[model samples]
Target: MKTIDLRSDTVTLPAQSMMDAIASAQLGDDVFQEDPTTNELESLAADTMGKEAALLVPSGTMANLVAVLSHCERGSEVILGDQAHTFMYEAGGISAFGGIHSRQLPNQRDGTLKLEDVESAIRQDNVHFPPTRLICLENTHNRCFGMPLTVGYTKSVAQLAGDNGIAVHVDGARIFNAAAALKINVKELTGSVDSVSFCLSKGLSAPVGSLVCGSAEFIAQARRNRKALGGGMRQAGIIAAAGIEALKTMVDRISDDHRNAKILADGIAEIDGLSIDIDTVKTNIVYFSLKRLEIAGEVLVNRMSELGIHFFELSPHTYRLVTHADVDENDMDEALKVFKKVMADL
Candidate 1:
């Protein structure tokens, strides 16, 4: 427990500078577009992602919901990976609140959706079928071992979406991690997409918030939708100040987290009872099955927590470890030692 917390990067604490910025931020009613700091954050985020405008929302989940509600009308369909955070973790807000239909495709080991499959899944112009209006993808996909969707892969799918007259949306909550890992520009990765939503809190270590960026016209529509969903907040500059700091300073250090993930993965791979495909780990999250250990995933999670090392399990047989800013090389070593001891007697 002394060293690592591998549950998720969402557990990361904000840096002192960010805290100071938040404490001293100038805030006004953001619902009235008067929070200057929030406005600046949105402008910078939109520019960074190569979009026309952006909106700040309370969380990445809300960002995704706002995007869906803005793009798809009730009874319309949106295509996405089955394992995507928007599909699997957002509690079907798009369906519950917007009445949107989701058309799901399997996520490959590399986190890219097959373009051919996406093309075939598009609904025809028929009265009975819900029209496919949007195609969604995740970069640095959280579920697929934090795998990064390559630029080529995204372009191919974006091409398919364009040819089929469907809009493309990227749930890029960990896009900076993706960019840093691939050593590519963020704008280049997102330029062809119709809209994108990324988190400020996860790897960036902002206390809370996410952003949705797209065409000016589209963003205007999303702003209205945000208010409709009660997502509009007043005087939100405190959070946006932290977001600004994260975008400025925390991005470059993500590779340290990526390197730590590899370190921990390599160590756990050497443990007798774990199975990990280190090759599939392109970013910060690591997933492996602990079947040989003959313990439930939750049991392992509890044991790890009690020992001051923490991790999350995907299912009964699958466990995951996510490295973040706080988990240094020393923490990785300590985690491995704990893993070996816990698995030795089993």
Candidate 2:
């Protein structure tokens, strides 16, 4: 049986074209700024996101951390959603390494911090409070059913931050997915932010790497932060080659992943013991819950795994599945069959 892996888009393999590009790529030391292929990738990334320049980093975590470090000084505070990947998943690198403080606001069901709430959270210029230096937003919010934040909402946040002299950084790991879902240019989503970090590994199908886009001066600062964090790479063109291919070939097809997610969501809704808010199936992520209280989420997940299907159990009752470049419509159908059978037997 073909094992259906739906855990996350991060599981996707690079395309054959990416491999070809890597094999023939020109190589040089990236730390010295002499790698031609890596330079090409950075220029392409900046152009794609409508930014002045871009810097390559090893992973999404490092990209966010570098962006935060470049924008804020020690003892400065950044406002972000409580459920943000930087806060919830990135191991608190910003606070630990940069001594920057975080002020987390509530993320709504649509994955936006209310304007009023954000305004209230900004610290006053008092001696006791850390000065607010930055605001962070996540596009295609992971925990919020992978919903894409609207262009209007992003501009509103940017305006708020600008008025307060705070820089805005977007953890845009799945930003292309957001653009495809919204039927808008990716630049429209990123134009207002001061800096944005996007992943090449997820959905884009690059083996490894992420890029941080911003003004040239900001990128120069971020490059220094990357080196300080031990993120600088030598002969990184081999990785950049694949990232170039992913950018050139993979972005247009993200809508297919979104379609497959809807298929999976609709199929799960038909199962007697499974439930999902079908309306929230906006991007490549599908989140559902086990309505049968007798069966725990782990039990169902284990049973499905044994049956050649795999996904994530987010809680005792909630589960998450993501569609990506590797998993096709047939895989969705097969996974849904397994889900139905497993739910019935349990």
**Model 1 per-residue lDDT tens digits across residues 1-346:** 2747788889999999999999999999999999999999999998899998999999999999999998899999999999999989999999999999999999887788887888889999999999999999999888888888888888888888889888999999999989988999999789989999999989999999999999999999999999998889999999999999999999989999889888888988899878889897778888988866556567767777778888777777798888888678888888888888887866
Where model 1 places Cα greater than 4 Å from the true spot, the runs are 1-3
Question: Where does candidate 1 clash, by residue pair?
Answer: 1-307, 1-308
lDDT on C-alpha atoms for all candidate structures: 0.90, 0.95
Compute the lDDT for candidate 2. Answer: 0.95
- In candidate 2, position 200 carries an lDDT of 99
Task: Mark the 10 consecutive residues where model 1 has the least summed lDDT.
Answer: 291-300
User: Which lDDT value does model 2 have at 63?
Assistant: 98
Candidate 2: list runs displaced more than 4 Å: none
lDDT of 2 by residue, 1-346 (tens): 8988999999999999999999999999999999999999999999999999999999999999999999999999999999999999999999999999999999998889999999888899999999999999999999988999999999999999999999999999999999999999999999999999999999999999999999999999999999999999999999999999999999999999999999999999999988899999999999999988876669998999999898999878999999999999999999999988988899
